[model samples]
Target chain A: MAVYHPDGPLILRLRAGDVDALGELYKRYKTSIYRTALAITRDQGAAEDILQESFLRLFTHAHRIRPDVPLHPWLYRVAVNLSYKWLRKQQKQQKATSDGVLEGLAASFHFLPEQWIERREAQEAIREAITQLPLGHRVVVVLFYLEELSLKEIAEILRIPEGTVKSRLHYARRFLRDTLEGRVPVGEIVYEFT
Target chain B: MSSRDLSSFDPLDRMVKEALQARFAGAEPSPRVWRRIRREAVRQGGRHRSRGIGDWAWFLLMARPTAPLVGRDEFPLGRFGLGMFLFPDAATLMTLRFGW
Candidate 1:
């Protein structure tokens, strides 16, 4: 009897130039990948672009990928790297924009609501808090809570030490807690998606 | 608050998880993304074929022969009883004869 290996058949078919296998892999992981990109970049268009680029990289580099390993972390690594690249580009462009200057000034001020309200409102508040995190912390939080990847997996994806991942997670959680408890008021959360 | 203070609030983790779930619960990539993926796959397939050995083989087969090795005055010996003719090279003639 042939033993079953998860992701093995799809990867094998992908290596053999089967487009259907690529589509299957995409269908399985696109949501997670898209969410990760969306969480990190906070831009729908950028997330979509990262989603496509990640899979295209997989298609082009399928031969080089080890069939013995799970493909998820590798895909995450590609998405994260692309997200960082996009962030860096935005940072550079923001330096030249007057609106970016005004946004920077607004970020320095803390704006807080008088009292917390409904569950839906609280959820939106938490989402805003996440978006307020710096890119490094935001990514770790997204990977940990949103994607539910282990510290080791996230470390491998980010090419960081496990200890570093732990530290980043700790910092991210603290930042979110502060925001949630009204100790910190991060102004005007930008909702990229309607 | 410090990291330890945050760690003590375990419920925050649950809250964050719930918020993330709620925020992206119904999120789906646009159909255009799949269309783009299919298009890119087709383009990559074309690139793979162009870089393949078969493409090189086809190119070599269709290549116009350099100035014929046999000139008007030269009667090259035909080993297989085939009539002497303007042949490019032994390899080309052999390839044609044996369908190599």
Candidate 2:
């Protein structure tokens, strides 16, 4: 019995100059890529852009990619790099804005309903906490938890050693645990992997 | 939060993962994103072809012989005279000078 490889045919078709193969690949992985980008960037527009850019990269580089290797890590690597670029750009813009002015603007921007405030606050807290993480730790956490990539795969995507990925993930979890100590209940938290 | 409190808590990885999943669940890229990608791909393809032509032109220019078509005497071997002291044999000197 021949095992079917979904990515194999699509990648081959893409290398053969079939644009529809690109679209097919997009349909298969867009949600996961977009969510990963959104998890890293915390911005809808930037996530959307990263998703498109990731697919575009796959399209352009299809000919050079080895068919024997899995394509998922390569795609995620591109998305992660683009997300970091977007985050760096956002940081630069934030730095350019005066702190006091930004604080005042943030204070005035609250318009959520009373009923939604708690939910929104919890969500915002998680997002803000993730954003506060150093980019290295943040990317590992996102890949491990959000994208459910194994340490080896994350290491491959990030082009780092597996030991580095493990340490980053360990530190990231510890940081988040400390940061959300009071907000998230101890019993509710679950460790997916040791 | 105290270190004891942090130590007592369950692993936060799952919670963070759940929060991310809940927040981004059902998220999809807008149609405009696909359109933009397609447009950019077309533009890049055109640019790649033009760049490829330019690369070939550059390669040909670099590959063209630098030596003049005139006699070997026209080109001074003095620039390579130091090589003669290291390799006194005529055949070896000729090979070094002509890069045969």
Candidate 3:
């Protein structure tokens, strides 16, 4: 039974006992998946764990599932669960860093003091608005804008109806627009992917 | 602006997308991912079962055996000890005197 991989042709090789296919899948989605994980976890280490665990699951199941089917949603499902587990584990392991202990003292330090006032203010304003969104709305926004999943696919990934995804997006857009008006600098909004 | 107004372009949408793209650029895989995943995969135990109904990893890893076999080396001849795993010497092969 030959099953072609969903996103890239490399996955097919994985089923044929080829390790190179696994490496290709890793490099292709690592950036976007890591970004999505980072957005949810808000910590680089936690996000890295999510990214790695998701791919590991992919490797383990490389021969079982239909390779032609999209793998990102399955990857997303694994990442989301792992992230929640990590968060729960954090509750049991509590040892605040020195940065947390002397945060008040460190607050007075002028780190990166040379940023243009308007540019820095605009960035802060955008971040504050995103942080203010309801968790569900924020996630939908991240999936749509960052991971670039379609609304239909987002609903499938979140296990909700498409209408609900659309509604949340509508509400999120309005909130962000109101919060960020007159703040974002005027020009083309460009993204230089690293 | 309505969806109609958004037909041409939308700054809010653009800004939101740009903001997310900028943040996503810094993501990467964790070092401890493999150990955790392999543990979970073993626990799952869903796929595989071809060679001998149980873990056939050794068989899969083993080299393929050459074909054709029929000799006094081994066979089910009436009971146990039909033939021992003994290599024939140069004189034994030239004369079949032991079989009778």
Candidate 4:
């Protein structure tokens, strides 16, 4: 409602005081943020939580927002960090379950659901192959392929080097190919589970 | 055949791309993220202003048009954004690279 350049400048001006801009921005990206969060965290509830927390962090750090600089990457970085924490927590919980218990628990969590049959088995196999990747590779693959973040953006989101992301993606691809083609056993894949 | 070309032509690489594309065959843009972000943006303003006068900077950032917009748009902006953020001009890197 305030008078200023109707282009991007006005958006920035309103952002200085107006709450409408916040609503407008949310209207734009809620799905990608939550979907990306869900793809990594693998929990719908956690994904929604991360979506809220990540945006909340963005609001808290708003002064750090550069009028001309990008926003999604920063928010992504926050969301990815939060998801990584959840992943780490899951790993710790799994580790605390003793040795063979993890495999059993994983079987329960990762196996075919009630509705799944032979056809679904094949689909599950594909996803399982992906889930079987080393944490690094899994993150890269999911973020790039499932969430559709580009290599460079993935780098920003993950706070890693472009070369590192590319290499991880490279290895993730080779590993997934082997897994899906049944050339490698799911348990044999060396995952950077940390 | 040259090694670079051979590596580039790797079936594994091709398969990965194929698999990913196949998985997300009907990938949609992230318009939904914008809606959620707007809600947090205002909630953020309230918290930041309540922090203290010294926290005015934090308040302004929540108010920035570019912040959440950046979050929703960054990945969607494609390879061009990738180059800018990941492989910025050396000068750009030099300036922003103090510490996280």
Listed for each candidate, the true contacts retained, as a fraction, are 0.34, 0.43, 0.31, 0.18
The candidate 1 chain A region of ten consecutive residues with least summed lDDT is A185-194
- Please, what is the whole-model Cα lDDT of each candidate in the order they appear? 0.72, 0.70, 0.59, 0.57
Checking candidate 3 for backbone clashes, the offending pairs are: A5-A67
Better of 1 and 2 by lDDT: 1
CA deviation > 4 Å runs, candidate 1: A1-4, A99-109, A183-194, B1-9, B46-100
- Model 4 chain B is weakest, by summed lDDT over 10 consecutive residues, at B46-55
lDDT tens digits by residue: candidate 2, B50-78? 22232344454334335665346744453
Interface RMSD of the candidates, in order: 7.6, 7.3, 6.7, 8.2
Whole-model alpha-carbon lDDT for candidate 1: 0.72
- Give the per-residue lDDT digits (tens) of candidate 1, residues B6-74: 342356776777788777755778979877986898788812222223325545444444458544444
The number of the candidate with the highest lDDT is 1
Candidate 4 displacement at residue A19 in angstroms = 3.2
- Residue A180 Cα positional deviation in candidate 2, in Å, after optimal superposition: 1.5
Candidates sorted by DockQ, best first: 2, 3, 1, 4
How far is B90's C-alpha from truth in model 1 (Å)? 32
Q: Encode model 2's per-residue lDDT on A38-60: one tens digit a residue.
A: 98887998999899889888988
TM-score of 2: 0.67
Model 4 alpha-carbon miss at residue A28, Å:
1.2
In candidate 1, what are the lDDT values of residues A1-43, reduced to their tens digit? Answer: 2415577777776777767778888999899999899878879
The top-ranked prediction according to TM-score is 1
- After TM-score superposition, the amount by which residue A84's alpha carbon in candidate 4 deviates from its true location, in angstroms, is 0.1
Q: Candidate 2: where are CA atoms >4 Å away?
A: A1-4, A99-120, A187-194, B1-11, B43-100
Candidate 3 has an fnat equal to 0.31
